[model samples]
Target: MHIGKAIRMERIFNRDTERAIIVPLDHGTTVGPIAGLIDMRETLSHIAEGGANAVLMHKGLVPCGHRRSGPDIGLIVHLSASTTLSPFPNAKTLTGTVEDAIKLGADAVSVHVNIGDETERDMLRDLGRTASRAADWGMPVLAMVYARGPKIKDEYDPAVVAHCARVGMELGADVVKVPYTGDPETFARVTEGVCVPVVIAGGPKLDSVAGLLTMVRDSLAAGGRGLSIGRNIFQAARPYQLVRALRGIVHEGWSVEQALEGLEG
Candidate 1:
């Protein structure tokens, strides 16, 4: 990694533990202004105050999401998008450039690609090009790879999830985000042989915090990096509280029981 890249990555991945808790606010682009996102500035403050390691968002939202004073968090610009209303919502296309993210003072850039989507080829090409550009600019790339297509019966299958992670690394992602495979043993298979950091996506907001925390704990136990969770943090009854709990689990290695009882309280 370039010296500049390493320095920037440290801002997101703690220099001490090298684990990260990223709260992504890029949902507005795809899902419109949902609850907890209508006021981007307020939400950003909550996320920052919670001691999150970074915030992932679209380039346009940065001007409004930045904090004037508070704990510092790394900024990552999401470069790929597609509205939820699209016929094929999984067919993500690159909408921004790595250079644009760099100019925006971003520590990294991210792209979404679906391995089984009909447009997979196009998305892969875009990911490849984006990674190449990011490498030159010393910017980290987070490839949000998933398996969603007619052929894929179970996107959450451990085997399919593992393939998604591998594809991200093959395409040159610094970090890879995919759905959790539901159990630690299955997830261990997902992370095995993957040298780069592999973070699990929060996916849709769940009905329970314990479930989310349990998944985080199991993922860590299985050798997963940390988390790039969004809604599970931002949409909770206590947003910052949930983030603090996540921090405990991801960085401090707190057990789910301990995380909920202490930090999440």
Candidate 2:
């Protein structure tokens, strides 16, 4: 790896733990200014204070969320986007480029590829193209791969999730994010198949923090590397407190019970 890419990776992935806790703030482009995202600067300050490794967002929003005083966090510019209002919502289009991310002072760039979606071919092509460009510039590419198609049965199936993770590796992603398979045993298979780091997406906001922490515990036990959670972290009653709880789990190996203590405190 080039020194440039290594330095960038150090910014995004913790230098000590070598794992990342990333919060995606790019939802506005898809779902329209949801809660916890209304005040970009405030939200970003809280995330940085909570010790998150990085925050992912669109290129345009970078300046809006920049922090002047809080603890520093890495910036990852999302390269693809697709609005929920679109007729083909799953069909993500490249909205930014490696050069764009670089110019924006991004530490890394990410791409979304719905593996089994109807537009799988196009998404795959996009991933490959982005990876090639990132390599040329020595930028790290994180791939958010999911199995979402009309023919898919269970998206949570370990076999299917593993396949999605592998696709990201095969196409040159430095890190891949996928939905957890619900248990440590089943989810273990997911990390086994992929050479690159695997991070779990916080699917939907769980009813309780304990439920969410338990999921994080299981994924870590199964060899997963941190999380790329959005709603569950930022939408919580206390977003910074929630991130501290998550940091305890991701970096400290705390039990679910132990992690939930911060929420109570």
Candidate 3:
């Protein structure tokens, strides 16, 4: 790895702990105009001020004029996409390259891979190629690996989830964002098998803040490296407060109840 890339990776890993608080704004690429994310600029500002360590977005969101106000949050340019208009949602194609990400001043680059989907093989190939390029450039690659396909009867199955995590590590991903398997014990096994950091994805918006906090706590207990939450935070009644509550759980190790109370106060 180049000295510069190594330093950037170190920064993303968090100086205080191995965990990270990543606010993902790349949803617009897939779902298009998600309710709370209609204004990318406002969302990015809230995330940065709320003490998130990093923010992941497409290149357009980070263009100089758009993100003018915010503390220096680590930036990870999402390099893959499958727009809502796409005929096949699972068939994600590369929209940007590591070189482009570097030119955009990205601290790292991210790609998504649907492990059990029909397009799995092609996506895995993309992951390998991207990882190789990132490695050569010394840039870290965050792989979003989710299980979905005829072969995947249950995404929450411990064995299947663990396999997904391991596949990301095997393919050279520096960090793997995966869905939590509903319990810490199962997730523990998943994290144990992977050498790289494993972070939990906050899937579709949760029913309530309490529910989201509980999931965050469970993931941390299961040895996850913090979170890569999107809708759950941004769509909340108080996005800034929600992030503070999540930060309490992830960084301070506060219990779900305590985190909620802190937010309410």
Candidate 4:
């Protein structure tokens, strides 16, 4: 790794645990202003106060959510976007660039690629180009890869998830995020097949906090580096406490039960 990239990675991943808990706040660009995103600063303050490793958002949102007060968290600028209203919603297009992220003072940049989509080739091209550009600046690239599209029936299939992970590593992503394979036995295969750090994506919001933390704990046991979750964390009844629980699991090595204990008032 380039010294600069390594330095930035430290900002997002805990130096002690070599893991991260990233909260993605870029959903507004895709799905519009959702519940938790309306008050960007307050939400960011909650996340920062809860000790999240970083927050990922689009270029425009940096000014909206970047903290002026409270503890600092790493910033990852998302470079790709596809609106929910789009006819081809899975086809993500580049909305920003490495240069843009650098100017925005981002610690890293991320790209999204849906492997089974009709526009898969285009997204892969974008990922390759972005990775090369990011390398020039020694900026870390996090690839959010998913097996979603016409050909995919089960996105969480361990084989499919592993393929998604491998694609990210092959394309020079410093970190890869994919849906968890539902259990440690399967998810471990996904992580073991990739050289770069693999992080689980919080797919859809879950109704149970215990369910969420259990998933996180299982993924960690499966060798995942941590997570890049959004809705489940930001939209929780108490987002800060949720993050604190996640920190317990990701950084403090707490079991699911132990982490859940911190969630109670």
In terms of TM-score, the best-performing candidate is 4
Ranking by TM-score: 4, 2, 1, 3
Misplaced by over 4 Å in model 3 are: none
Across 181-216, the per-residue lDDT of candidate 2 in tens digits comes to: 999999999999988889999987788888888888
* Per-model C-alpha RMSD: 1.0, 0.9, 1.5, 0.6
Ranking by lDDT: 4, 2, 1, 3
TM-score of each: 0.97, 0.98, 0.95, 0.99
Which scores greater on lDDT, model 1 or model 4? 4
Off by over 4 Å in 2: none
Task: Quote the positional error of residue 48 for candidate 4 in Å.
Answer: 0.6
Q: Comparing 1 and 4 by TM-score, which wins?
A: 4
Among these predictions, the greatest lDDT belongs to 4
- For candidate 3, give the lDDT of residue 193: 97
In model 3, what lDDT does residue 163 have? Answer: 91
- For 90-137, candidate 1 gives per-residue lDDT tens digits of 899888998889888999999999888899999999999999988998
Clashes per model (N, Cα, C within 3 A):
0, 0, 0, 0
Superior candidate under lDDT, 2 versus 4 = 4
What is the lDDT of every predicted structure here?
Answer: 0.89, 0.92, 0.86, 0.95
Q: Candidate 1 local accuracy as lDDT?
A: 0.89
Residue 230 accuracy (lDDT) in model 1: 92
